[model samples]
Target chain A: MTIPIDVETKHRIVVVLLWLAALVALAVLAFIIAVVLWNGLPAVTLSFLLESPRDMGRAGGIFPMVVSTVAVTLLAVIVAAPLGVGTAIYLTEYTSETALTRVIRFGAECLAGVPSIIFGLFGFIFFVIQLGMGWSVLSGGLTLAVMILPTVMRTAEEAIRAVPESFREASFSTGASRWQTVTQVVLPSALPGIVTGVILGVGRGVGETAAVIFTAGSSLHIPTSIFSPARTMAVHFYILAREGISMRHAYGTAAVLVILILAINTAANWLMLRFQAKQG
Target chain B: MTVARREKAIERALLVSALSAVSMLALIAAFILIEGAPVMLRHGISSFLAGTRWAPTKGSFGILPMIVASVVVTLGAMVIAVPLGLSCAVFLAEIAPRRAANFLRPAIQLLAGIPSVVYGFVGILFLVPLIRENLGGPGLSVLAAVVILGVMVLPTLIGIAEDAIEAVPRTYKEGALALGCTHAQAIRRVILPAARGGIIAAVILAMGRAVGETMAVIMVIGNAAIIPCSVLDPARTLTSNIALEMGYAAGDHQKALFATGVVLFAFIMVLNSIATMRIVRGRR
Candidate 1:
C-alpha cells in the first residue's frame, strides 16, 4: 500500500512518535517512584520500621505490617513453588503435545487472566467462610498462591524446556531411573530459572492488595498465627489513602511497598537475564 | 517398591500436581458460582444485569451503571494504551538498539510490578485534584480511571506485543525490503499484518486486566453507583462496587457482591477465550 506522505519523512515521524511513547512509559515509572520516595523516604526512619502503628495508623510505625508482609509472602511462595515447579516438570519432561497438556495449559492461561478480585472472592468464600480459616494470613497466602501459580508454572516450564535433551540422555545412559534423571539432571539445570519464577511470584504476592485485603483481613495488629488476620503494606497504604486517615503514613507505606517491589522485580529480571545468558 | 513402580508413582504424583491449575480454576469457578449464582437466579439474570440502581441495603441490586462504567472505562483506557503500547513495542522490537532494548525491558517489567494501590494513591493525590480543578465535577471520574488503568496495562500490552512483533518471520521483512519498500513501509505493511493476531490477543488481555482492577478503581472512581453521562462524571465499576461493599456487606448484600464477582468473572472469561483463540490461530 502507498501512503500520502513520503516514505522517509513518514519513517522519521513514526520513529520519533515511537520514541516518545517509550519515553512516556519511562516517565510514568520514574514519576511514580520519585513521587512516592520523595514523600515517603523521610518517614522510613529506624523507629518507623521497628514500631507498631498507633492511633489507627495516623501515628507510629509499620512494624506489624512488615511482619505480616513477610509472613504472607513466604507462605505463598512455599505453597506455590513446589506445585508450580512440579506442574512444569510434568508438562515439559513427562508429556508431549497432547490434549491433556493443552487442557492444562488452557486452564493455566485462563487462571492467569482471572482478576485478583475474583481470587479474593473465591478465597473469602472457600478458605475463609467455608473452611473457617477466616480473614487471616493463611487465607491470604493461599489465595495469592493460586493467583501467582500460573507465573511460576510458565517460568518453570520455560526453564525446564530450555534444558538440553542430551543432559537427560546422559543421565539415562547411567544406571539412573527416569525419575532420577529428571530430579538430578533436568531440575538442577533449571534451578536458576525456577528461582526467578519463585521470586516473580514473591513480588506479586507482596504487592497484592485486593486479594490480600479480603482474605487476610486488614488488621493493624501483629499476627500471632497463620490464622490471625493481618494487614499487608499494600493494603495498609490503600486503607490509609482511601479513608483519608494519614497522608504521611500512606506515603510511607507506599514508599516502602514501591521499594520492595522495585527490589524484587530487579532481582527477578537479573536472574532471568543471567539464566538466559547461561543458556545461550 | 520396584524401580518401575517408583517411577510410575513419581509420574503419577507429578501428573496430580500438573492438575493443580485445572482444579484450582474449577474450584474458583464453582465457589464463586455457588455463592453468587443464587442471587442471579433469584433476581433473574435480565433484571439483575439490566437494573440500574445498586442499593444493596434496600435489596435492589441492578448493576447496569457499574457495568456501563466498567465497559466505558475499559474502552477509554484501551483507546489510550493500545496505540502508545503498540508503538513502544514496535520501537523496541524493530527500531531500538540492542543495549537500549535490554535496559528498557527491565524498566517496563518494574513498571508492571508497581502495585495497583500505589497507582491509586498517586492518582488520588495528583490526577484527582488536577481533574477536579480543571475538568469540573468530581475529580475521581471515569477519566481518572481511564488514565491510571491505561498506564497500568501498558507493560502487559507492550511486552506481549513486542514478542508478537519479534515472532514475525524474518523472511517477511526481507521480502518487503526487497520490493523497494522503505524500512517503515516493510514494517507497517508486512510485519504488522503478520503480527495482527498477537497484537489483538495482547489488547484483549490488557482489556481484561483493566476490567478486573479494583483497589485503584475504587480509590479514584468516586463510587457513586451512577451511569456516567460523560468521561468527567463520577462512576463506579463492578470491581469497585464489590470491593467497596464486601467489607461491610452481609446476608443478601454479601451474595450481591459475589454476584457482581460472577459478572466480572464471566466477562473476563469471555475476554480470555477471545485472546486464547487469537493466540491459537496465530500459532497455526
Candidate 2:
C-alpha cells in the first residue's frame, strides 16, 4: 500500500482538483448574488418601494406585494408557533418511547418531505374550495402554517432535549409540578431555540411562492383585509417574469426578495451561534 | 384540581396538539385521493398515465410526457449536482483548512436559504438567454432547468455529504496512512467507503428535492407538454403542468391535476422513505 515517489504528482493533482472544485462552488454562489444585486439594486427606489402599480405591474412599485407578503408570513407565524411548540413539548417532555410517538415523528417527517406544490393543491382544495375561505391571506397563511409546522416542531424538540436533565430533576425536587417546571424553567432555557425555529419558519413563509400562489389569489390590488386577494413578492416576480411584462421590475422584486431572505438567514445563524455559545 | 388530574389534562392537551400533524397528513392524502380518484376511474388509469397527448380542453388528459419530463430533468440535475456536490463536501470535510471550512459552511447555508423563485429569476435572465443564443431552441429548456436545479440542490448534497464524511471514524484514516497510503488515497479508499451509505442517502434526498421542485421548473422549463428529445428541448414536468393548468382548470381537468399530484406525492414518499431508511441503517 506504500506510495512511490512518483505518486507525489498524483497526490498533488488530487489536491489541486479538490481546491478547484471548492472554488467553483464558491464562485457560483458569488456570481449569483452579484448578478442579482447588480441587475436588481438600481431599479429599487423610494417610489418603487412605496407606490402602487400604474399599468399592469409595468410602471410602478411592489408596495402591495410587500404588504401581502408580510401579512401572510405574520399570520403563518401566529398560527404555526403555538402548535409546533406544543407538539415539540409533547414529544420531548410528555411522551415516552412508544409506537404512537414514532408514528407522530414519521408523520412529521412525511409532512416535511411533501412538496410545496402539493401543499398548494391541498390548500386550494381544502381551504379555498371546501372551507369557503376563498383565495386570501388566511388561506395562504394556514397552508404555510401546515408546511412549516414540522420544521418548528423538530427544532424546538431538539432545543428542549438539549436542556440538562439536572435542571428538570432540581425543579421536581423543589416541589415544582411538571407543568410549572416546563412553563417557568424549561421554556425560558429553550426560548432561543424556539425563536430560531420561528425565524426559520418565517423565512420559509416569506420565500414561498408556489404554495401561496393558489391559496392567496394573485390580485394586484392592495388588500384591505385578510380575505382580500393579494399577491406575494415571489408570485409577483413569477408573474412579471413569466409574462415578459417588465424585466426591470422583475429584477427589482427579485433583488428585494433575495435581500430579505439573506437577512433572515444571517440573523438565524447568528442567533443559533449565540445560543450554542451560551450553552457551551 | 388535584395535581395528578392537572398533569393528566396537560398531557392530554399536548398529545392532542401533537397528533394534529398526523391528522393533517391524513386529510391531505384523503382529499387528493377523493378529488383525483374519480377522474382516474372514469378516464381509466392506464390512459391517464400512458397517453402522450394532453389536450384537456378537448377532454384528452395524458401525463406521460410530463412524467418523462420530470424524470429526465431530475436525472439531468442529479448528473450535474452529485459529482460537484460530493467533491465540495470532500474538500470541506477532508481537504480544507478549518478556517476555510467554517467560512464555506455558512456561505453554503446562505445559498440554501435563497428562494427557488430567485433561482428561477436568475435562470430566466442569464441561463435561458445563454442557452437560447448558443445552444438553439428556446432559452427556457431542460438544460436551463438542469443547470439551475443542480445549483439549487448543491447545499443539500454538500451539507449531508459533509456530515457523512466527517462521521467516518478517525481510526480508518489513520490506519490507511499508517499503511503508507497518501492522504488522497486514504480518503478515496477508506473514508469514502465508510461513508458510502450516508452519501447515497444524501443523493437520494437531493433527488427527492429535484423531483418535487415546482416553481423553478415552471419558470424555466418552457412549459411545453411534449416529450423532450434533447437537453435543449423545452418540456413540462408533472409539477409545472399542475401549477400552470390548475388555476383555470375545471371539472375533469382539475381532477386530472390532482391525479398528477398523487403521482408526484407517491414518488416523493418513496424517495424520502428510502433515504431515511439508508440514513437510519448507516447510523446503526
lDDT of 1 by residue, A22-102 (tens): 889899999999999999999888898999999999999999999999999999999999999999999998889899999
DockQ of each model vs. true complex = 0.87, 0.70
Poorest lDDT segment (10 consecutive residues) of candidate 2 chain A: A2-11
Give the C-alpha miss distance for residue A36 in model 2, angstroms: 1.5
Could you tell me which 10 consecutive residues in candidate 1 chain A have the lowest summed lDDT?
A: A2-11
Q: Model 2 over residues A13-110: C-alpha lDDT tens digits?
A: 98899888888889988888888889999999999999998788999999999999999999998988998999999998886879998789878888
RMSD of each: 1.6, 2.1
Docking class of 1: high
Badly placed stretches (over 4 Å) of model 2 are: A1-5
The runs of at least 3 residues in candidate 1 whose Cα sits more than 4 Å from the true structure, single-residue gaps closed, are A1-5
